[model samples]
Target: MDDGDVLTSAGVAAGLDLALHVIRRDHGSEVANAAARRCVMPPWREGGQAQYIDRPLPDEAGGGTAATREYMLANLDAPLDLAALAEHAKMSIRTFTRRFREETGQSPAKWLTGQRVRHARHLLETTDLGVEEVARRAGFGTAVSLRQRLHAAVGVAPLAYRRTFRAADHVRAAAAEEKA
Candidate 1:
């Protein structure tokens, strides 16, 4: 293949995997991993929507909160504490605490919970991984924890969320196929 030329699989999903592979090659694994993680995409795509998924934005806007927001989003699968986040933002725990609430209109803990829930939602939609794995990846740490958080966020269990979204996807796919 020439420099400008590329090869891809037959399905649109395969094309996305090829694009992600190129991204991983060009930008290094960390960037590619973050991109994939934010979209709740698996490292390998086999008829999946990783390539076509829209990336979600973090809550914080520009200014001092930008760096902290990036740090939070990048580290969602890890334990996050207010002190650590404040330190990352290079502000005192007190000031950072206040600013975080002012900027995002949610406490750091609440924000983190929301982020995790969002991640969980994505995982439910796209991946076939079990709820435990989804919980871990979403930073919930355990299925029980994920259940509580997801319930709080959306008033439904993770499995139910998966079933709902998956069914929805299937219906959409059938409709599209019929049209085609």
Candidate 2:
């Protein structure tokens, strides 16, 4: 292969495999593994989206609590509760709960927790913050809470997660510096 070479595969499955192979070679297995785990994707699918597969399409219908959801995302560090969310949405508690479930397929608390975990994961992968700092930034209130939540969500400790992603980053940075 040459510099700036382009290789195209015939099918989606082959393309996925080629993409993963490139990532693995460039970033190492730990980074590729971390990407696969965090994306909940296998890196390559055997038969890409076959007719018998059950893949739900995106929801084109918009309205109902989307604004509130955006607000929640913005104020992740705030001590938000069901009552706060309901008030923001101008919905009664019961009505908000029902609508939230219908829209997200999860309870408000569950969804919020998942989002917090995702934030924590991003911090772990991208930042050099300590666990306690990451917890505070991720809105987990405390390191213990962050650890418990992370364990429950992704079955890995914060340090381990950071190691997998950040170590790969450090390696890439060093390689770039060396080339420079």
Candidate 3:
């Protein structure tokens, strides 16, 4: 079978290990191993390496962009305009917009929407909040807007995604309790 034709397991962590293996193969064992260590993940295994993992963000940046990113994450539920973000970063709007895209490969608006969606996902997974409350807390302004954004990002409505992840989380928690 071709490389593209190959198939493997079906779990998130397994896919992480598989990707790590490819990284190790292409970039050298030391670099990949170092990355796993930094993430506090276990070493990769060959057998369980065919799952779907979420893609991670890019590496760190040296500029003030990191501070801006931290601020964005911290204020995910707050109303953030370009001017506000620029002022926070102590840069002019034009310069901040340019530098933010250069550093993150996404416009400020797009990045903020992405962060809000992620925050909503976490709330959906971990909390018993209603969809409208999650929408409000995640700064999407309205449930309709939150539905649109979440549907665009994950190809599923917020409730559906929440049901799936919530069930999985419950199962995992039950298994962990049993093990204990």
For all candidates in order, the CA lDDT equals 0.79, 0.78, 0.81
Candidate 3 lDDT over 75-176, as tens digits, reads: 887899999999999999999999889888889999889888888988888899999999999999889999999888877788988887788878989999
| Cα error of candidate 3 at position 38, Å | 40
TM-score of each: 0.63, 0.66, 0.65
Cα lDDT tens digits, model 2, 1-180, are 213577666565566666776788799988877777776678645643322122232242674877787788788778999998999999999999998888888888888887788888888888888999999988899999999998887667889778866887899899999999
Give Cα distance to truth, residue 37, candidate 3, Å: 40
Please give the TM-score that candidate 2 achieves against the real structure. Answer: 0.66
Q: How many backbone clashes does candidate 2 have?
A: 0
Task: Mark the 10 consecutive residues where model 3 has the least summed lDDT.
Answer: 48-57
Candidate 2 lDDT for residue 47: 46
Q: Of the candidates shown, which would achieve the greatest TM-score relative to the real structure?
A: 2
Q: Which residues of candidate 1, in runs, are more than 4 Å off?
A: 1-61, 172-180
- The ten-residue window of minimal lDDT in model 2 covers 49-58
Ranking by lDDT: 3, 1, 2
